[model samples]
Target: MLDHLRHLLAQDPKLAKVGLTGGLDIWLFRNSLKILEWAGSARDSYNSGNTGLIQRQAVRILDYLDGTQYVQTENIPSDIQPILVDPKIARVALLEVSQSEEPPGYLKHIGNHLREIISSPNVNDSQKKLANEINLAINNVQSWYLGVHDDAAQLIHMSPQQLHQPGTMMTLNHMFKLANNAFVGETDPATNQVKEGVSQIHYEAQRLATFDIMACSNNETSRPCV
Candidate 1:
């Protein structure tokens, strides 16, 4: 599923330049950490056995996360470097996820890191702004999810008479239609906000397209699309 999604994004001219966004990004980061934690536990459980393969895989993932630096100094595209280099943004995202009622250890670790960064005197305004944006984006998506779930629960718990009522059915239909629109990149009438995943992809595509046109007008080469 991950590979397929990556391929789809890569093939699109606009989406090709986009990086991770919303729940998908958090999900991948969380799972990557979980993988390392699980591998360590397995190695500990089987001390006598050869765990070199699992250890090596974990090391590679860690290197990808921490070793490779994406910053202003590197060959990374200027448009995307801010996102790639801003550790505070990633930390804020993880912290947001950690705020769940029952967050896991990995999330807690992320929260701690975010706290440290927030408390540090060296942090800059750009980092703080990036963190704020990430948090707001996450909160928007969470609100949409909660609203949709509540509407779904109403359908699940409705009595037979309530289900049969014309008004009840209409309300349910309206709620579902709103959800469908949000799912496919439309603005939610109730909240007046676009769904995060859909909006992120759409915005990136539009931004990239505009950049390409501007580049062409200037007679400069645009970034290659997959």
Candidate 2:
């Protein structure tokens, strides 16, 4: 599933841009990281085979996150807070662990059995705090998953007429700017071509503006705005 998603994104730059703008790409990428972390611990035959592919995809997502200024660290969910706080550690765990003959025991020690570490008699205050933060972070990932899905569903169900409302259009225009910035230098693997991200955004903005005008016109009832 991850491989197919990556291939689809590579083949279609427009679809990739849309996914980024819609927040689906980042959501899936973050989930992939979480799944990779789980699979790393399990190390069973089924999960082990796809570890390399998931790692590569995670790396690509990390690169995109690093390059794009639009996705702020704060925008990422708390569960994946380590990615924002200590990106190097996250990168090493994702990219290097699979290459090792044995499981990366050091990485495993960080979050695995966090509850046990927090409750152990020998643990210090700092260690307990770290364990609590890890636990919170994991919980945050689950929160983000539910929240984003609800938001996406709301947008999906919106009527075209409702979407063309002034406030919604303004919000969309702002989102377009952010998406344009993120996709600025991205290359489409299918055509091996770079897209004019800003230009496309400008065009969309103009179209929206035109829609706003048409919707506000005297013949509003005669012609459908959407």
lDDT (10s digit) by residue, model 1, range 141-199: 34543454344334334444554555544544444443333334456699997654324
Poorest stretch of ten by lDDT in candidate 2: 204-213
Best by lDDT: 1
lDDT of all predictions: 0.35, 0.33
TM per prediction: 0.32, 0.25
RMSD of each: 19.8, 25.9
- Candidate 2 residue-wise lDDT, 152-213, digit = tens: 22333344455444554343333333333223323668998654332232232222212122
Model 1, which residues run further than 4 Å from truth? 1-124, 177-226
Give the poorly placed runs of model 2, Cα more than 4 Å off: 1-29, 32-112, 138-145, 167-226
Q: How many pairs of residues in model 1 come into backbone collision? A: 0
Deviation in angstroms for 50 in model 2? 34
